[model samples]
Target: MTGSGFRERYLDVLASIYLYNEHRGYTSLDRVLDAVRQRCPDDAEFQAEIAKHRADEEKHYRMFRRWFERQGRMPLQVDSGVGHIDRFIQWVFRCSIEELDTSEIVGSEDDFERLCRVIMLTEQRGYAQVEIILKNRLIMSDPVMKRIFQIVHKDEPDHFLPYQRWLERQGRATAKWNERAADWCIHKILMLAKLPALFLDAGRPRLQRWPDEDDAITAH
Candidate 1:
């Protein structure tokens, strides 16, 4: 590929991976909300914060969808394997996001604290990555994509704050050394292994529909 071709393809894959993660983010937050409701129903403040976080994730997902729409092409299909939070949950919980036992988490204070730390680490990682992406010339070359990430960059700090505060209020450390190590490892793996693999695989399929379409259908 020429230099221009490589840049475009790299941005495309990068945005697609981000799109997938944003979708995964809100859906996983749905489960977290469930656990919060069952475990701490009286904590309206925390519940509202999580709701806002979920809404932001959905908003980011839609912006990326519109970014793809403007290009007149679907994003490349990516799965949980490319998702940072997905991998973090797997590594910490020893199960996929879908397999996470929210009930078990709600029933155990220790499990809930672990969940909060995991989310805090993931959101912090996201904020850090967005800061880097905003500085990337290829990402900044497209005005619309740059604006989308700018919005993300603004919203990201708020994403982890609530979790961190909750952990602090509980007299627990926001994150442990092991959890930080795991988060760092997950990011390196995605940057080095998964992203490069996706970039090279020109045969990768694109998503036929937006992720939110399923929710739209289910609403009917």
Candidate 2:
């Protein structure tokens, strides 16, 4: 492929990976929501906010998948070995996704808020990343990619603000620590884990090809 063609395909692959991660994220967030319910079953507002968050995630996953379908292709299999939040949890808590769910990662209310901070910060970072893509004239030149990120950008604040509001209500002094933890997990460790995959995938042949052509109609 030509250099520009490779660049376009690379961006397409990134979009597919983003879609895959959104699916992964919502699944993980569902687990988090379950834990939240266990911790505060009676907090109607928290419950409602999380329900909306869950719905938005599911919607975003569908949006990306549909975008792939519109291109007459299936999404690339995401590199799940190292996702942002997953790696963060593994590094900080030393547990796999399955273990993170089964184990009581939060012993007290403070710990629960800490977990919330991690997710809130993740969404905040997600918004920024999407914003960067949207602002890039070259990337946004593609109407489909632009529209997808635009939708995602709109939903990010919903994911973030509710958590921030909840944290504000707590009147706790843990903000700085939580921010630091988020940076460590998302910016430092997870990025490190993803670096190899980025380098390895570069210039790969037909990186965005459909995995199974016959299943396109039923793929979701």
Candidate 3:
């Protein structure tokens, strides 16, 4: 692929980048579903929001699945650069939850805002990567790929908007001490948790970086 030239190979890198991101997203949605369903206030509005994200997740999963299916590979099993990174991200979320629990700093408006912030980060990260993926005409050249990214990208942005509103509300509200503490703990936990995955991601597409010095069957 590199023989095509550095500039030309930009498409290759861009595609690989998003493919990795997609893997993290589809996998993480299940966790998000669990968190939202189990914890979000049981109000009608909250339930509606959960349903909306659930539907969005299912649709997004199919979008990536369709594109990967066309590519003749299972995305999860394939080495999308972000897969390992995602593992670390999951770990970090776990850490955040643990921290929040121990901090005894939540159960109010601020807690909700913190939760929204965490979710918002995920959506933001996904959107940025998806934006690139959807823009890669060469990668999306396959009709299925183009359609998949389009369908998925359409509703993906919706995930972030509501959470953003939540944050705006937090800024205006004076949350209780518990809420403030919970938010602080969760925030730090999330930031700290993200490190490991990113650390491993430093070495990616090992073959791409090193080139032909690899065994095709094993690497591929």
Candidate 4:
């Protein structure tokens, strides 16, 4: 492929990946919100913050969906394999998001604390990534994509603050060294292995529908 061809493919794959992750993020936050509501029923402030965070995630997801719509093409099909929070939860809880027992985590202080740490780390990693992408030449080449990422860059910092503040209120460390190490390793593995594989596979299948299609149906 020519250099321009390669760059186009790279942006498509990158945006698809971002779209998938954003969808996964808001959906996963549903579970986290559930846990927070149950565990901190009286903490209205915290619940409101989490609600806003979830809303921001959904907004970002829609922005990427609109970007794909403008291109008149579906995003590439992607699953939890490239999802940062999916891998992080699996690593920490030894279970997939579907298998996670929110009740169990909320029932134990230690478990809830660990969950907060995982979330904080994941959000921090996401913020850091958006920082890099905002400056990326390839991402900047597409004005719409660049604008989507710019919004994400603006909202990214606040995404982790609620969890970090909760941990601080509990007098617990925000993130352990090992968890940070795991986050670094997971990012490397996705960037080095999974992403390159997607970029090289020119015939990769695309999603049949938007990730939020089902939610839209239910909302109606």
Q: Which pairs clash in model 1?
A: none
lDDT of each: 0.93, 0.70, 0.49, 0.91
Best by TM-score: 1
Q: Give the clashing residue pairs of candidate 2, or none.
A: none
Best by lDDT: 1
Say which prediction, candidate 1 or candidate 3, comes out ahead on lDDT: 1
> What TM-score goes with each of the models?
0.97, 0.80, 0.53, 0.96
For every candidate, C-alpha RMSD to the true structure in Å = 1.1, 4.5, 9.7, 1.3
Tell me the deviation in Å of residue 78 in model 3: 5.8
Q: Write the per-residue lDDT of candidate 2 for residues 51-73, one digit (tens) a residue.
A: 88988887887887777778776
Q: Residue by residue across 36-56, what tens digits does model 4's lDDT show?
A: 999999999999998888999
Once superposed on the true structure, which residue ranges of model 3 sit more than 4 Å away at CA?
A: 2-42, 76-112, 172-220
Q: Can you write out model 1's per-residue Cα lDDT over 23-78, one digit (the tens) per residue?
A: 99998899998898888899999999999999999999999999989989999999
Error of 2 at 96 (Å): 2.3
Q: In model 3, which residue pairs have backbone atoms overlapping below 3 Å?
A: 105-178, 105-182, 106-178
Candidate 4: clashing pairs of residues = none
By lDDT, highest first, what's the ranking?
Answer: 1, 4, 2, 3
